[model samples]
Target: MNKPTLLFTAALLTAPALLALTACQPSGPVTNAPETNANSVTTLPISELPLHAEQATRLDNNLWLGVHPHGDIQIRDGQGALVGQQPVAAEFISQRRDAQGDFFLSLTTDNQLMFYRASAQGISDLHLSAELPWPLEGMCLYQPSAQELNLFVMDESAIAHQLLLTRTQGELLAREIRQFPLPPLAEYCVVDDSTDQLFVSEENIGVWSYNARAESEVLRKPVDLVKPWGALEHNTGPLAISQGQLLVAELGSDLLHAYPLDGGDTRTWQLAPIAAGQPLAADALTVSADSDKTVMAVLDDNNGKVYRAELTLPARAGDNQRIVQVAPVAETRPMRKSGDAADDPAIWVNQQQPELSRIIGTNKKYGLYVYDLAGNELQELVVGRVNNVDVRQGFSLKGQAADIAAASQRDRKAIALFSIDPLNGQVSTAGEVVTTLDNVYGLCMYRNITDNRFFVFINDQDGRFEQYEITDSSAGWRGKKVREFAVKSQPEGCAADDRQQRLFIGEEDVAVWTLSADAGAPTDMTQVAAVSDVLVADIEGMDIYRSDTEAYLVVSSQGNDSYVLYQAEAPYEYVGRFRVGINAEKGIDGASETDGLTVTSQALGADYPAGMLVVQDGRNLLPDENQNFKTISWDSIRAVVIAP
Candidate 1:
């Protein structure tokens, strides 16, 4: 977050109606629902079948119990009145959902871990996903998404290893299994699901956070998220997360403890204290905090008794823990190159299916990479010497509307073209063409929606800029000379406002300038951001983000390691500036000396449901590892600079 550091004469720009997205809420696996199917395959209604509560979970307005022995599940209202139930073999039953918001059940059998497509009627499509690689003496499944799950499965050898399980079905059933080492004493586990974070309670050690998305070696086990929670060597029971608070059953003592999700100061209460044999053995715990009703249920395993009580977290939560709770969530992985710089990122929004959208980024020394919102690389294009990359859609070529991406190839002194598959979201080479400018350095493309034309701007080391109007020819794509101009100094970052047909260029050593997008039009070499003023020298990346009534031009002020924002309209006015700081919890460093960056206002997925800002980290140090891109949620940006 940042404030305007400079004063200007311009009046306050018009405010925009920042329409909140109503389509999204706390409605994932973390939220509440009235009734849910708890079966992998069709059998019979759980209510009609005779079954007992093996494990109880709180859903929307009711409590769901895993009716085992026959593997059925039942739902009961707040007053302990039976409402609905379903019969299916769901032992370790947990409610999950696919990208479409369709409910599913994360199930575990004697020898298999699986999921079942569920509906109000019943459950079907039993995906017997993964077989027991090693005998799971103990296991915990945290389903944050259909494909993203953190699993702690321990073998009889007393060695615990966390596995990230993934499953996708279509043309073929694709399954992936990656293992992460965990503490040997790790026992019970609980998931926030909203974030891919898990809380594991060690029998001897304190509770720890298990994040498989750590920014280390691809499949390496992540270190502690915040810090090891609770007193060391304390025996703790199960865990339940509700309203940013973690409820714990203290097995070592006759008490229940609650702590802020960040493992800050905690509060405890006695539960069956000083009883006869075992003073209230709390071996299992479940709390319904995602719904209107607040209740907690715990199992006294040694006493063979289950108790339900009202649950309320202390109102005294420290501001520090609150800050950690609101910090953005991210997933960082290694780039293709172990020592290369992570430069530039482009966000592609798949309207039909948001989950399929890809984040295209350049692995400077390796090639271009395509990744999902989870930061998992889906594809990599080994094009050589690629510097800056830009993408556009709805370009009709060969009688078909195509999505084209272009990158500046420094090795060949040319611009390389690639086509993207809309369905599968893959990148393939279209053609290669040389640039008109010599020693091409910076590159960006603009597509005019009104005229259905593509214009690419390329600049060189000598301050010469070339704007080319691209069109598909009978043989291949060709560029026609539009207009050539020279700035006062060398330039790099460049972007165009397609709706306004205005081109803004960044002269690295001078400042930002704007001109007309039309060829042969009058040039406006006006300095929008001067060096040493609102902006610093060596501006590296520039991109435009638009809301309903406002647009912002963001430029990387590499000198200060921050980004300056401005109103994208004519007579461009300054907005504010912000620097992406380090995230020690996820083991990620912020952007510094950013080469290129991209932003999208389109809600990509849960991670970026309100949109996101991705920047290139030129100096990814701290732990001394290869550079990697860092993604920040637009909500975090809007809270400071963009919000009214």
Candidate 2:
């Protein structure tokens, strides 16, 4: 039974702020309804079950399951007759029936989380499949794909845990992928896989919705509230979602509320008033619907009498936001420190042996890290606090041709340089060149295709950018400031296209601007893309993926944890956006709040035949390790966003 006492009102007195979260909008403006007669739609009790059970839910039109007083599960028909029973002991149960008529159950046994599977028609005999030692109050299952199943569990202290479950060699395994906080007294949770939405009921407050995708931000929006705040007369009770409506039961009333998942008016159903000898308490509820009819079941907590009813509801309206989802093929090792340690990544292609290529990443808190194609840490250069890094090949240093890498060393307020041996792929610190700016933040390197002259562009946090000509002489290497420019606001994460002689820079809170890569050419800036629905704010990383015939620019929309693609040529057309989702099979969590990224079109090996894109994973979850970089094959991205 739902807890009747509303003991969390003072803690949640800041209702104005919580109600303003717009990620999950309400069905519509809620109007207060009377307690005894709430826009009543009559519902008649079809049957009553005589059993001492705590909770009851409908499996199909003819079968229902409940927790009997004997600690086992009991099955009953629609006409209130006992049919079958399953002796599985469960303290709490959550059931879901997929489109294929397969039933999945999440049950809490003592402090362990267990999963059961059975056919909808044969639910009396369930197959115990998976179990994990998790002390959770409730659990809900979300299926991202046909083969990937994830469980979201609610603990006793109002915390949510997302775990990915897998099977290997007939053994089941569960691993924690992510975790987030929930409002105090959060009791019930249900997920709509079709809409990628998670609805959690706060006992003393209302129903809140969240984006169920593992890669999405943790933003909760209100669905409805209690009393003068919204529409309910008392605290919220059990919640069920079916046919696009979030069905909510009132904790201490005979009324039920149905809120359309999409925008629409709320509908209230008034159950028949209690008679002289009928069960009086409505504690648990279940709802299911098809194309033709909708059915609801309510459990009487005191006497274990089950009540069933039919509902006539309007059609469900759907306006779901759709985006492509893909997972990383590999991930680098965790950084040495936590927090925002990893900032940028640059890939170095080995011309002699593509498989021997390496990845260069900036550990802003420490120094630099070098990793091989298989994500093994090969070397570390402890220079200073480097923010962003870029790599270019074929630079003359000390009368020898070498690969050059540059990063904005914030600690030194200069440009940190490294020389990579082309033959052995070893990175050694060359030296640093102080900049005129007070603070150097972002850095990128470019080489002129016409004269093969190398240059590095460094930006300050105050929006000042200075281009320096990097030349090699007898005294190692030197940098001379050539041109200086500034944007209206802070800028970082710039990429240079050597083939097109163009440079692209992301103005953190503004738009992406393009200028000439040649130091002597005009520094006219052109707005390529602005912050919008697809391209969210705080645009961090920008890179170009160029093949022999086509090129596309990718930008990290840090505000939304998604990446937006565009045509790299003039009049850049918006292509699409995609998110790096969790790889349940490999146990690799997706990237979120990315800072800097790099991509190359040169084939590295069999794993990344069409090149790879490396992005800094700001919040690395699966095991909650330190921040690191993730590598995704370009072909995997093209298959979803660019395939025509």
Candidate 3:
């Protein structure tokens, strides 16, 4: 048994003046202290940066800042001093500082807007600016008429929705000026000031553009953005705009896409590997307009930090540009290797046992592995084909021995109870398997804080979902079917927002289904967002995160190639899309069929301080392969934009 540790909570009171003073520093600027030196910086050759560039800009004269190896948004100068930085909170989506030098940040913690004034003294006067009606995922800063700064936030509320042109004075005081409804879980939006239109990228559906002036309707026909390469990865980062062209980062392949602003032609630029063996996460990316050229920054999540380089244009002189890699900055911790078959990671933060934080990962062959915050495998529980797993506390009729015994004898002769051992990584059958669920794909634990009752939601491969009650203890659980819902297609991923009493289900080649627990029975199924296009292929994994008032749904496309991220629609809106994949060259013998995904936002352990997303590379199945798992740093994963 893992011993539980005690925790105490104490409120620290400080004078408002002191609090204001610390806010001025805003986590302190990256200084060129003795800690960071040029000798410590590694500069790969320009050819190593790979991908051909349609357009490249020089942001600074000194050195080209590539992607940050670390996850933090710190753009460094040639000397390695932090030039620009943005601080993000848990569940927060995106941050930007406009050309006017005003800083805008989103708070996923509560779907609120926290603004900061950046002065020479640093970031001071932090204040809450606006309260969104619902939680948000992706956000962008646009100048509608050059007089006002319009903040557009993506909300996947009921379907896909958008908060249009919320005008804010400067960057701090933001108020809602208008709103618009969009397709479910739109990935990213780019404002074409040249045409007074906003182009939104909807994963599987295509790209739709709406007139900023006419908020009621879409202006352009939806265009298909799918590439032969496969479904794009999800949650990489923001798209880039350069010289009448939109640059989109492809998550599955090492390719940068260029879409003509006039909507005439689309082309792809493949990035070459910087090092012979180095892998690229391509999570987050930033572009800067330099005096003479355009510079781009791509974050490598597989490695810890960012890569700064120059984008080289095409040979047409105006069409071709070159991207050069320059410097790298180190983050707090080095990226760890994601475990083999480590899928669907869930965190159980014990309030009664605060220090007893445990992360349970589903391993198809090895059962569930519990790990401490330090990334040490504490124990492994043997559950067959553990596609999905969750934990909650409580008892229900479904888990009662009488129910299990009756159900076991009536249906399958097997019992349905599990026993776990923390120290020895062992699990034994506490009861027989009651009913062999047909294609059990997803699982979640629903806790009723009000009554302390726990419920389980499981998604079956046969286009149906079942609910059960837990009667036994945390380790030993018996389940009885309470309700079932049909999804039409294979239901691969499922997540529950207990606070909101909502569940998100991902269907293959269909939209995501949202079910309200408050309504009697599980039949009240509604199409919250469509995944037919957003996910490259069939949706296989899903996870929901609630930060304050907002809820985020992350769905995996096991068949296609990437993960799709959606914000709640009716109560939320489609924010943006992110892409996930192992770097192109890093693939085992250069293959790209990636399947199975699991994500967590809170730090699971010390090694994974910011949280993690684990995916399975189908290419690694070859018996001759040296390693079974490929782990990318979560920080690096959030650095680049999967699509522009």
Per-prediction tally of clashes: 3, 0, 94
Over the stretch 196-236, how does candidate 2's per-residue lDDT look in tens digits? 78888888677777878776666666777775666676778
Q: State the TM-score for model 3.
A: 0.42
Please state every model's RMSD to the true fold in angstroms. Answer: 15.7, 5.1, 22.7
- Candidate ranking under lDDT, highest first, comes to 2, 1, 3
lDDT of 1 by residue, 1-644 (tens): 11112111111112221111112211122221111123211111111111245456555534445434355656665455666655655555444456654334344555566555443343455565555657654555555323344455556554455444444561112122334444565556776654445666655444455442322122112111111221312356677776666666665444555656544545556564324444556666666554443466666566444556665554433432111112225534666576445677777777678867877887656678888877787887898767778888777556566677888777777777887776666788777677667788788888887888887888887888888887886665777768888897888889888888888899898889988777768876767878874587778889988768668898988775678888898678887777675443454445556778888777777777677777776555445456666788877777766662
The better candidate by TM-score, 2 or 3, is: 2
How well does candidate 2 score on lDDT at residue 234? 71
TM-score of each: 0.50, 0.87, 0.42
Error of 2 at 560 (Å): 1.3
Where does candidate 1 stray beyond 4 Å? 1-328, 338-340
Best by TM-score: 2
| Candidate 1 vs candidate 3, TM-score winner | 1
Residue 217 in model 2: shift from native, Å?
Answer: 5.5
